[model samples]
Target: MLLILSNKKQLLLQAKSLLLSASFQQLSRSSELTFTCHKISAIFKQSRPALFNNLYLAMSTQPAKDHTEGHKIPFLLDDHTVTTVRESKILVILRGLPGSGKSTLAKEIEQKYKENSRLFSADEYNIKPAIRSSDGGEYAKLDEDLNTCCERREANLIVLDDTHHDRERLEELFDFANKYHFIVVILEPKTPWRLDCGQLKDRNHWKLSLEELKNLRPALEKEIIPLYFGWFVTKRDEDALRKTSQDFLEQLGNFKPFKKRLQAYGYEDKHKLDLLKYFGKTPNILHCTTKYCDYGKVTGSEEYAQQEAVKKGYSKAYTLHLTALFVTPRTAGARVELTEEQLSLWPLDAEKEVMPKDAFPRGSRAHITLGTATEVQDVQTGIDLLEFIKLQQAGGEREDMGEICGGRIHYYENGMWMLTLPRKIELKTIFSGYYGKAGVSAPQRGGKKVLLPTCQVM
Candidate 1:
């Protein structure tokens, strides 16, 4: 028996070497030989189980080249690359149906943040899974607990685990986050069987039926609030625009009025204004921002995105006519003139939000930020444009400083300058949402810096 076992091991080792040396395609070219080979392989696998198992394990564990490149699922947050923020508060809201693994994800997040995180769950508060009149009291207590945490600044990362199917409930949480200045991030589970009602019926602790799960799906499906909705510039157009913007900036630097304004703003070296460095490199994709939905925390964000016109416009192409280029002390951008058809995607109260009392047209604030000044955010570009519009409305000073780069320049108050082009520069763009990364860092109110490994933007 010992001699037979030794011979079997020797034969298997030789077969392994042969298998490694020859490709399966090469071996399978001969039909008769292939059939014989399969028979032999099956015999070895079935009879010599111990030896074959080792061979299988070794072959299976061999490293292969990764082909995914840098592409990642936009909604999923990687656990390994999670970062920590200093003096910044984060509110992570988990939304999903019963048995959708929200609790499991919340626990994982809690473990990752450890001491710096506080997790709130409906189950802990003895709140029933279904929406009911009696459940309101339990939910109120949960909110109070969360409020206390935010008030005392007890945790850097606060996680709320619940179905969150109700829009009103989400609104209440958004209000709390806004008041406390906490960055809100809404996450849903990435489990494959999350929406499979049959699987959920078996997996759910509540033992919810398929009917109940089906009813919940509609509410969640109707609204999907993105990070921010806007028109994305194509790669080819973006390159062209970059060059065009650079040329405009160069000519403006040499202009005498622009130079005179810079000198007034304490730029002693008129030659060294360096408009390129003054307005830093664009951080994100060049696009006209429509609505800044801070991850579904913004008021009426879901409803707005679900509007028929907005929904139809999403991912659709439109040619934006660049009417002018404007520069403020804080930002530099191109003013976009939306046509009647394009104005359908524009939010009704877009301008009213900026100047509530003033009655500017619906698409008055439509502009793409070419660049922003040091320490200034990209959102300021829209605000600056509105300021320019307000002054224009009030009949503020507008000195025509002559044409440069086929556009006439005008100077407003405090280094505010604009170049209105005679011929509109048109660029094709697609309406979409920006979900790249969360910019949640801000000045710390007062507390120790907490290292949160899982508080990442989805």
Candidate 2:
């Protein structure tokens, strides 16, 4: 076994870490062939159970070999090469009042799926401790995991486990599967996740006051919610609904509706509106829809999203988040007067809107730069451009660049101050937005080839 582990570095390292600290009792529980803490802890002085990656660690807890058919399944992913397995995407939707056992159901689903090698759970992949609900990045991380699994050349199957209560969030996953030519299995509960007032209070873990009870979910059986950002259009007027629907459909087509609203960033409507109202003069402002609820229905937060995810799919997927950008100057104010010697990158072209007409826009935010500058820089430069934002905010309730934040004062290779805000307003990738060389999907080689890189079962 040691000889085999040395040949696979990642697995060996992971195995080594697990083997050293695991309890002897726990070691006996693991299969000899699979990743196990006992196998990994063999080299370590003490078992550092918390140090192991949860997905690998929890699964590794059963440190033993699969001895069947007079054959043993290898201990590592590298060791157990096999025939293809079936994969499909799942969206488990739980709808109910609070204390409907939605979270418990989700866990059961997660345990069931992990038995398969192809399964990946969002909780296992997205959060570090796995069960904790307070982590800040569960949503974005889950999206990343789903994205990675969809793009994997080696993965034959993948499931997006999550709750999808309504069309808004569920549709995104459905659309993603459709784009990749994969099946979407939507699991609706036999009943939504809810219980009668009397029954809910009977549960041992149930906790809620009479005042707080109103906010809890309603009486439904399958307490699950879909795991993506979403919305719903509601109105009493028939003509208004039709008009609103048409307008919304058009907005969706342009990807404008998803911008900055509940679908884009989960934020309060008033704050979003404050941002939206400013765009009247700046038409490039994106039309983002604030998260829509049923007049007063309280929507779930990030934790509910992951629990629902656990129930939604056949297997769970892994997640990662990446944010990087290319710098470009804003073509305004002080930047207009700067010389090429003082500034770098293309001067912001005045003719274009702050954002392209077709692209979805985000609320204009204020950012401040507090570094010593020897000269008044060109607005055409990124710093000058961002400074203009600071100037605009100075006029409103905003005084010091929206909120105080920090980053390095980077100088271009040619010595120009670059002041910019964090990553915001990136457009959602649309199927129609595919642009590559010669109409190819996504040009891998670069010089303008259209290349749409998706997937297929090999």
Candidate 3:
């Protein structure tokens, strides 16, 4: 007999002899309870009526467990009923080290079901050179493949084969299961399989070593924790935003305040501002941060992550309204106005971060960081937003910097500027739970090149 506690669900694995020999008297006397009495009673009632009668007799001789502390037995669940329950459409999410038999188990399950199941493997897509060319583009392709499978699922089981070390990534599949009303069954091996095995090594497959995997787990989890969630700009809108940002940066150079500040810093090149280098590279993950959890590192983050409403809304798309663009010496970002529906997803205490309690409105710091200053981390963008909001609240006289690129520039103190767009840009975006490593190179296959545009907008 064996007992396992996982995700609050208990599993009882037993031999037939143990099941047959188990009596009410023996069950009542045993200190180790594998299952609640009601569960045992229900199972016995269906499988062995005689045993259940004896169990009822034994229950009459002793006090029953308090109802509040025990599960209510709904019905006598027979083996057939149990089998029927298990036969429902299931999403089996396989998670483990690269060589730890995930794909092997997936294949076995697929074969067992044959025509009643299908397996979706990320590795299958990874091996194709044409699909593996763009950085961060594989996620979109994987989503497309998974969505396609979910839409046309005529099977009892769908096996998702991937190295789902990140919880947010796993949540993406979970969201699909929740939408399609499929039960999620997560399978993870206890021990990691070696990635450097002879056969695996010979295949030239991408994998992480045991040590590297161990080191990466925390970082991946931290990133996956939705430190901040926001709507990613659509492909069409992203192009316009990029152009608008570049033109704004060039226009900033013409301003007297900016010129004086640059000259003060001993910069004499007036012909060309080279603002692109000053603002640094554009962010790989583009979205406004509604809340920053700091990888569950901040207080109350754990509670926030576990909120039922938060989980229910995970990965749902939203339309964010861009109200204005803000700039400081340290950052360039967009101010977003959250709607009523969006506000429901935003935590009440999100704005309490790095500020005096109740100082700013709930969603005042909602902004997308276009670029960050050299040596500044992305999180600093939120701080810059808070600073801008605070400055506005202090009621400074706005220096009308006039119209530039169809937007009005109003200068705030301390080299801070707000360019309120003539019209709010309504952007269509999907909620990506986690952003992977900032700029990872796409995997190469077979020494072949995939032709891509040099000036791609998205």
- Give the alpha carbon lDDT tens digit for every residue of 156-257 in model 3: 567888767655565556557645545444554322222333422332246444455554444323324544455555444555676666666767767665
lDDT of 2: 0.29
Could you give the C-alpha RMSD of every candidate to the true structure, in order shown?
14.4, 24.5, 15.4
lDDT of 2 at 292: 16
- Per-candidate TM-scores read 0.51, 0.24, 0.50
Per-residue CA lDDT of candidate 2, range 73-116, in tens?
11112111111112222233333333444344444444444554
TM-score of candidate 2 to 2 decimals: 0.24
Residue 365, candidate 2: how far off, in angstroms?
55
- lDDT at position 179, candidate 1: 62
Question: How high is the lDDT of residue 381 in model 2?
Answer: 32
How big is the positional error of residue 303 in model 3, measured in Å on the Cα after superposition? 1.6
List residue ranges in candidate 1 displaced over 4 A: 1-224, 269-271, 436-458
Flag the better candidate by lDDT, 1 or 2. 1
Candidate 3 regions with alpha-carbon error over 4 angstroms: 1-119, 122-227, 261-272, 435-458
